[model samples]
Target: MTRRVALGVTGAASAAVMSGCGSSEAGAGGNVKQPEISSPIDMAATQDVPVGGVIKANSGDVTVMISQPAEGTFKAFSSACTHQGCTVNAQNNNIVCPCHSSNFTIEDGSVTGGPAEEPLPQYPVKVDGGRIIVG
Candidate 1:
């Protein structure tokens, strides 16, 4: 009886650890509230990304992409794809939706494939003091 009980506890503990591995540190135990991060960003030394290019910015629970329509011009949008809210990681190519293979043009965040009808929400960004600020 003692050995069985010990094994049961061990199995339960292992299952708990395995289940918690599916989420980020803030939500390891589930119910991860969105974090509050309003600190200003310092984008000094960042190059002026021309059109057809992308720059990644990490803020809060989402990543921001700063692209441009032409040299010295810039546009910012969410890195998360609208479909299924997947993180679009392919910076060199169209923003891809991982859940359903939806594609989005980097220039305007238009849906190119999959079931997503909405584009990524634009986030305002500007260069100040030689640093890019996303607000």
Candidate 2:
């Protein structure tokens, strides 16, 4: 009986530890579906994205990250991380995946470090009347 109790306790402890190892954050579970945008998305005003900075826009079905590497020059990419299909949730000058710590450059979505072998998929973006439009 004592042996059986010890086994049960060990199993419960193992399950608890394993559960904590995975992220509960959205898009971090690897199975989370990436948002898909079929139509042009109005992301933000050109002035909202500072030079050398990035902004994330969610348009119901898709998430896009827009970055301005230089004044009046705008670029866009899918927010999904290339490492494990996790959506990037953090950013500074770089996009960061909260799942496995993958980091990507905002200039062209190139991988900087942390297990991502491919760059984030790029999208076309343009500015019209000071609004950033992405498709």
lDDT of 2 at 13: 100
| Candidate 2 per-residue C-alpha lDDT over 16-129 given as tens digits, one digit per residue, 9 for 90 to 100 | 977754655665545445456577788889988889988887666677888899888999987877776777864777788887798888889898889889988888887889
* Alpha carbon deviation, residue 115, candidate 1 (Å): 1.6
After aligning candidate 2 to the native by TM-score, how far in Å is the CA of 54 from where it should be?
0.8
lDDT of each: 0.61, 0.79
Q: Over the full model, what C-alpha lDDT does candidate 1 score relative to the true structure? A: 0.61
Off by over 4 Å in 1: 1-40, 43-45, 48-50, 60-62
lDDT measured at residue 48 in model 2 versus the true structure, 0 to 100: 83
Steric clash pairs (candidate 1): none
